[model samples]
Target: MVLNLGLLLRIPVAIGFLFFTIKASGQQRYFAEKPSISFFSDGLVEDITAANQKVTSIFDALNGEIAFLMNVKDFQFANKLMQTHFNEKYMESETYPKSSFQGKVTGFNANSSGTQQVKAVGKLTIHGVTREIDVPGTIEVNGGKLKLKAKFLVKLEDYKIVVPQVVWDKIAQQVEVTLDFAYRPL
Candidate 1:
């Protein structure tokens, strides 16, 4: 009877250990969901400069999902007129609170070295319209951190965002967006 009890206890212990080992090994990726990403504009004459952008994504040693957020309030303007027009006419922040991108890393090879440019194909939803887009960007993995940088152009008309003729001269037709992020595995 004692032998049978000992065997039962050992069986449970072995099962528990295997379960934990599988769980630990299977969870190899980490993610952040509320990363801050932003865009900027310099009147209608000059190009915009976007900086200090943040992003939230899930990535392992292989691949993951990434989502971006754009705060309309973060945009700075040279004058109040441009700001008011953007808030009231363009973007319609009250109706559409945020813009987002959801996608996965395609053909990712984490072992790559130097400056490697990869194609990230994903769905971008802006102003409630979701569109599939392929963006070209560079991914550099150094130490244990991954750095990503990409620039893409978004058309206002595609998202049903209309720029009034009255303020047409004040806004650019196409907005240039830049995204830079540093990710660590969890």
Candidate 2:
């Protein structure tokens, strides 16, 4: 049996094409390292604040795609009783254990090596309710690393988070959420 020269010549070209295709389709991915998320509520009776450091995020610099995930129960409050109540009574964390956001980053320049103001336009899911939102944030790029910071207000009623009459004076109708994420290349 003899091998055809034409067929053998086409093998290298086919392999090269396959490699290029794979490389082109593989977008750059960045994973957050120790992301921080927090929220604060100022009410007539008292102020409440909580934070969650165990958050996960993935960012695609090339296409401006980003996503975030965190367990609802991970938020920690200064008052343990408040934390418990937040999870059970307010958030219903047992039924909706996680919160997430998925969307694209607008007004971002991937090639720029400085801080750029951007907006994440996407769906935010919390307490089993999803709503489309546009969140303004800043992305700082230095030495090939990325850090994202943003603060936005979330209306409890939008997500069906009910504040009982007994606690109306203690809980605010809206809460300010802040997040900071440092991402490393994946």
TM-score of each: 0.70, 0.85
Q: Which sections of candidate 1 miss by over 4 Å?
A: 1-26, 32-55, 74-84
Q: What is the lDDT of residue 22 in candidate 2?
A: 48
Model 1: per-residue Cα lDDT over 122-181, one tens digit each = 778777788999898876777756777777888888899897887778777777777766
**Which numbered prediction scores highest in lDDT against the true structure?**
2
Supply candidate 2's per-residue lDDT for 61: 77
Candidate 2, superposed: residue stretches over 4 Å from native: 1-26
Tell me the deviation in Å of residue 17 in model 1.
26
lDDT of 1: 0.60
